[model samples]
Target: MSQTLPDFDQITDTLRALGAESEAAENHGLLCAMLCTMEGVTADAWLDIALSGTGRDALAPEPPEALVTLFDETRRQFDSDEFDFHLLLPHDEAILAVRIEALGHWCQGFLAGLAVGGIQQPESLPGELPEIIQDMLEIARAEGYELEDDGEDEAAYAELVEYLRMGVLLFREEFRRQYAKAGEGSIH
Candidate 1:
């Protein structure tokens, strides 16, 4: 697998070509959340959600090879202790509004992924996770922002992204600790 993530636009195009209803950012969010919350989340399971409502079975469509690579690399990043996971969003060059909207979608997808991953009660989760989940819920509900083309919005966006990245890492770590305490095997 490649060390770096696949191009954002390329994954978006592939999703479109595969008739996936979810956008790349949202799909990626779902993938990340599932990886963080669940014990065994396969690419096929992710595709089942990502490709839902398209009237085609995920396997029947034979998702593009790039998508498989994307899943592998993303899983690898999450498994590593290097903190290399990243949200799949538009590059810095994209319009701020577009990026913000995508961020909301990403958060929405993440919440949905938690449900899909069998996290029945996020509020019951240990430590600061419940608060973080609440914050993510608020972010998912955010609609729009009134702002200029100033650097402030860009900086805020960067901060939000970083917060999300760290929050997800924390979730993964906490869950892994729980599993370890329960005498469960590695959550791969």
Candidate 2:
């Protein structure tokens, strides 16, 4: 939703040109997760670090401006109240054309990003946060299911995507709450 985010192809190409190791969907998912975990970390800083780190330093050409613009748009979308956070997944047509395992990759990338962003589990999690994270980990390892022409598999996939979407929002809220608590205790 939210006025249609950038297409996966453009993102994939941009990341490829920058010599990023992860694919587009997973890479963006990782960024989103990092944003959630790092609290006040800026998008620009994350991009710089990700691009300049490891095998990416050999890339001669600078990344396209559009890539930065799209990333900023995604950050704005997450901060906006009108939109529900949707995972940067492949479009249905592409998914139907081939068994794209972008969802699992996205989850895997998200977990990696969270870890890299220095996410630390609280001694006690609030609400269903722990379960939600566990579920995402399981989903990261899930195999792609065939989409039956009858639409059953599609329907199931849609539900799973919805769950992923809601989980991200919940995770954001929980992280914020935990951060606020830490800030509060520090001042006391």
Candidate 3:
């Protein structure tokens, strides 16, 4: 059965309590994306390293049990057929509450996760992933980027988020297909 997704506030609060700077939604997205690129490792294993500061020392902190459950639920949701994944962005009464900087942080965390998973080879990446990844790196560096309060800018931001969501799904499918073609076993 499909499980209820974790509440964003709860997850974010938990991350904050754990001294984590990355938002839960971005963290989950990054982890899932890395999982797609991995050859031999389960989500739990990756989470342990991620929480242990294996890849980046600045992000080191032991996540609370609730945060662990959040990660598990995120993995489960990605593996489900519903594909109802929602980006962990805040929406103002109508406008998206998340700033452009937050998206940058999400992308930053994602690249970090990818590096930790040993999927940083641009030559091995298929499709526009390389370009997107590069773009994400640049976006991660955008500190003072500002968005106009117009509806058009909001639309553009929404489109970008949607593109990222699809990118995650595409990477997952490509990796799974590659694994199948290899006729190898997953490290699950």
Candidate 4:
């Protein structure tokens, strides 16, 4: 029988990579635990297996005082300002859609970087991503009202686009409600 893996938190500190800031302390632990839960494997081992030898190393466990450090750094970056652009996205879907928009821009830049860097051999990127990723990408494109794919069936893509639009609208409302739940003087 196949054995279950262990869980672990997001501790990716490899080189100049800026890892995503996990939701909360509990989420941090849970993320780590979830990582380990699959096949009870280590983070390094999982990356090695899932990501084929990109030569990227597993992130080390963060120090206990990491939160404090982040807080201090964040405070300094903003200079105690009440400005935050997280308003338009209060829910997960909204956040994800925005992130996808950002990602699309980043991806275009990366593709350009590859050409500028004069890399002779093309590296395997976005390799073996699950079908769910494709679906999510399609969904995000739809959410942004983008329907520029000219190869596929137009009607079908339009339907999918509409569905994503509905989702985006609903998620926007849900996000606003969540911000409302946050109490008075909150950015919404």
Candidate 5:
């Protein structure tokens, strides 16, 4: 069976219970970016970043089971031969504004993840990556739109999401090629 993302609200609740301050969308975005850019990114490393500001210590609680499941399922999506990876965002039924805001947060987190994954100089990257990073920066700052109708706004939102999904896949492929050329092995 095809693995699917965990429920957004459920992951949100789990993160809250774990004292994580980041939203589910942002956290998932970070995870995707790290997986793409970092070699052998482990679940523990991701947890360290995701729970960074929570002030958790050695005596702190472990990540909840639901969050762990989310991490595994998301990683599986990237490894799938079907290219089924997708962003973790609020469902379509959510208010358009809420969804839009979440998408922005996701983009912000993705950019942050790229930095965390050691991509400090995006401008020097090969192919379309530099432009893609610029586009993500703009999307991250998005607040609201001035579309004429709800239908139009919905179409626009869907297009943006699709673009982001494809962009991420491209990043993964390009980075993998770079690593291979340098004999650095593949990202996990």
Candidate 6:
């Protein structure tokens, strides 16, 4: 069904979908922790993989060692902003519009970091690009600009983040469903 924009289940599902790529429950949990509140970041959903400098990208030529460091640093820089960005956004409502825009910045950095040599990702044509890239293309359709296409040609990396964003969007939709019936006289 072409669901309503205000559904609560959908929103929460968007919140959790980003962590699905992790094989380890702990990995998922840990990443999820970054997005959720302290009370929500419990052990049950925590993933073990620590976000650090040594994390490797199976596809990239440049071992993602430094990328890990960049991610941690970026996270620290953005951590405070996430809270303020969402402060006015209700659980089932929209997150900050600017944050959505900033997502492109993060995607650019992530994808650019994964590129090798110069211009274009190592992704070999036809269909090698991840689902995320396609999703980002879909997301970027509105803007109609070449995003994250740095000298490295990390479009595939951009795709990966786009996919993650799409997943998060789905999780958000699911969340809207779960919470649709919560609270009386609700303004959702």
| lDDT string, candidate 1, 149-174, tens digits | 89888899899999998998998898
Clashing pairs in 2: none
Tens digit of per-residue lDDT, candidate 3, span 1-188 = 76765666787787676556567766765676566667555645656654553333344444466656766776666677777655555543434445565677678777777776567485558888788788778878866646677798777787888887777677667777878888763322
Q: Name model 5 segments beyond 4 Å from true.
A: 58-61, 147-149, 185-188
lDDT of model 6 at position 160: 43
TM-score of each: 0.92, 0.82, 0.77, 0.22, 0.92, 0.24
What is candidate 4's TM-score against the reference? 0.22
lDDT by residue (75-186, candidate 6, tens digit) is 3332333321111112312333433443443343223322311214323322323454445345434343444524333445445444554443342333234345553221
Clash pairs (backbone) in predicted model 1: none
- The CA lDDT at 39 in model 3 is 59
Question: When superposed on Cα atoms, how far off is each prediction in RMSD?
Answer: 2.5, 3.6, 4.4, 18.4, 2.3, 17.4
The true-versus-predicted C-alpha distance at residue 135 of model 2, in Å, is 1.4
Q: What is the lDDT for 103 in model 3?
A: 72
TM-score of 2: 0.82
* lDDT (tens digit, per residue) of candidate 5 on 117-180: 8887889887898898899899888766655656988998999999999899998888778788
Which lDDT values do the candidates have, in the order given? 0.85, 0.69, 0.66, 0.30, 0.85, 0.32
The reply for model 6, stretches above 4 Å from the true place, is 1-95, 116-129, 137-188
Q: How far is 124's C-alpha from truth in model 5 (Å)?
A: 1.0
lDDT of 3: 0.66
Candidate 5 steric clashes: 0
